[model samples]
Target: MNFTEQALKKPRALLLLGICFLAVVVVLGFFLKNSLISAEDTDVLGDFVVRRSDNATSFFTFVSSIFDPLGTIILSMLAAGIFWLVTRNWRYPGFIFGSVVASAAFTYALKFAFHRSRPPLLDHLVDETDFSFPSGHVTGTSALLFSLAVVLTLRASSRSVRILTWLAAALLVAAVAASRLYLGVHWFTDTAAGALVGTGTVAIMSAILFSQTKQIPAS
Candidate 1:
């Protein structure tokens, strides 16, 4: 079988892929935490992004707020609920809820473990007191939107629809990541690592939780 067919048919392949992604997250986390990748080096892009913003600060601030901890939880539940209602199946909803919770838990645990500080208070556009090695906003947003994109892709009627679903999900996640940098609340590595954590969580969770399930046919 070809690559796509093998990927679809083999849970072992998915599991291996998921493990690979998560291994990268761990290695990246270790490097950042140990100062092997200096914060000053990683913060350069963040500084530039924050400094370049003029009138767009308000817009990015608003975007960041939408994916805060509480916001992420609410959106995850709403998406899970909608998936259940539409599919009349528990697996999709379960996948959504489980992936998000796993992502949030992983992100926060890394933050606590790393104990890295945020940008200077003077640079921050929003008040934030927590450790900032891995941005919680970007992590949670990526997990939720990326999981939804996968589910939607499975149910998409055409190739174009699947492409659009993935594009939209990616844009949303990137916007949230950029918002964290633009708000001066996180370093570039923080957001990048957050994306890795979030995506890794979803990948592993999907392999374990949904790989055995039959694909939802397109409408």
Candidate 2:
């Protein structure tokens, strides 16, 4: 197999890569805890987001709400159901469910461990009560959308279709991450770390699931 095939097909390599990503998130949290990045940096960015136009605020608020906890659960289940209907393979849906749960669990654990506070409440455009080292919204959205992208691309016959699937997923993930910053509920590091955690969780889960199965269905 070529290098790309080896990287994608080897469970060990994928798991190791996923672990490396998670490790980076831990190191980033430590830096933030030590004021290495400085709260002033976040505050400056938060101020900029908070002062944006009302229309921008409205647009982001809508975008962020689509991936709230309830929304995430609903969308994830819907995606899983559709995958099962199309492929008739439990592994695809199982991978989706597993990635979402693992990503959410990991994100919450880090939030409590880091005890990072959100931006000032007065600056917040939406209500958020949790510690915000890694944004739960970004984590959940990234996990779900990226997992879907992986599965869709794997089954897609055309290069353009695969590219489009990945591009769409990436854009949605980016929008969700931006929404957190635009809403003044999370620092830039929070969203960045959340994306890492979510993507890593998907990588690890996909490796585990694919290793158990013979091969993903082509159609």
Candidate 3:
């Protein structure tokens, strides 16, 4: 099937892409996050992540630094409240809240299971943590924001509004991932892994929700 052809018309051709992308990400993360990397490659790639950090300076790093776990949590709470007030739908709120909780928990569990260490910091701008692979910031924010994006796009009527919302959501996700890497707290691969995991979680939940959409009565 020509996805591009379908995407131009159907738009939600994202459903199929989401499935394949999630499946591949899950499999890749399973191996990379757990299996022992070669000492040479580990040293090389680890150095590359660090080298990417070394370029950071006064404003670029700070400007690129767009996320904090605490901020995301607070925002999620406020967004949840607004969402509840506007729609009065409980399950969707539950889905958003549940996605964040489940994604965060799953992230930490993977971190502990793999027991990957934080990037070897040359200069610390902020507090450091123990296990660093699959950054909590990236996973948490992406899970919440992307899930909300999916919900909004699904429910929106105006084509322009839906497209704009999705674009903004994608930007937010990218910023969150970038912030983790620029801060030197997470390796590039760690951010990649976190994004993949977060996106995969969103995809899984979307599939479930889409399946159930048929049973829902029109509002």
Candidate 4:
């Protein structure tokens, strides 16, 4: 392997890095919730969203609707099925399942800990309840897509395929985060924290699994 790849393959280093990132995100998220709930940020963004065309609003509404908790679970199940079929191994499938679960669990835990309220009813395009410092939909979708991308890229043979897969996965995650903002369901910081949490879960899981196998999959 090249020097850069060699450097990045240190499992311990990667694990530490992931933990640090997750901690920073959680702390930052706690602080940002205060500013996000203030009238300045919410009012400005809400006003901008109100002016958008009906079709555009509907599109984001659809995007956020399909990325809810139930939808994320279904996607994870399907991913597990695909992982099993492709690799014919339980190891990667189990990893995917665990990572997805971890993502959801942590997202909710953080939400409860913060107890931050969602955007005002007046600003909401779709009504939602419960704490919303970090968006559950964004977290789960990011975890599922990002983990799938990492797994697929590791299994792929061609450099071009790996690059394309990473790009596609990134775009999907960004779109989901954007939907949360466009639909006025979450603040920008909420989605930001969600992305960090999701990515950190994948990173920690990957480091652990990689340490066991050296390579992610035997195939």
Clashes of 4: 0
Top candidate on lDDT is: 2
A best-first ranking of the candidates according to their lDDT comes to 2, 1, 4, 3
The model with the greatest TM-score is 2
Q: lDDT tens digits, residues 146-193, model 2?
A: 888777777566777777888898899889988888888888888889
Q: Per-residue lDDT tens digits of candidate 3, residues 72-172? A: 56666777777787778765665576667766777787777767776557634556776876777887778788878766665466778777877887787
Show the lowest summed lDDT stretch of 10 residues, model 3.
1-10
* List of clashing residue pairs for candidate 4: none
Pairs in clash, predicted candidate 2: none
lDDT of 4: 0.76
- The global Cα lDDT (0 to 1) of model 3 is 0.63
* Estimated TM-score for each candidate: 0.88, 0.91, 0.72, 0.88
**Worst-scoring 10-residue span by lDDT in model 2:** 1-10
Question: What order do you get sorting by TM-score, best first?
Answer: 2, 4, 1, 3
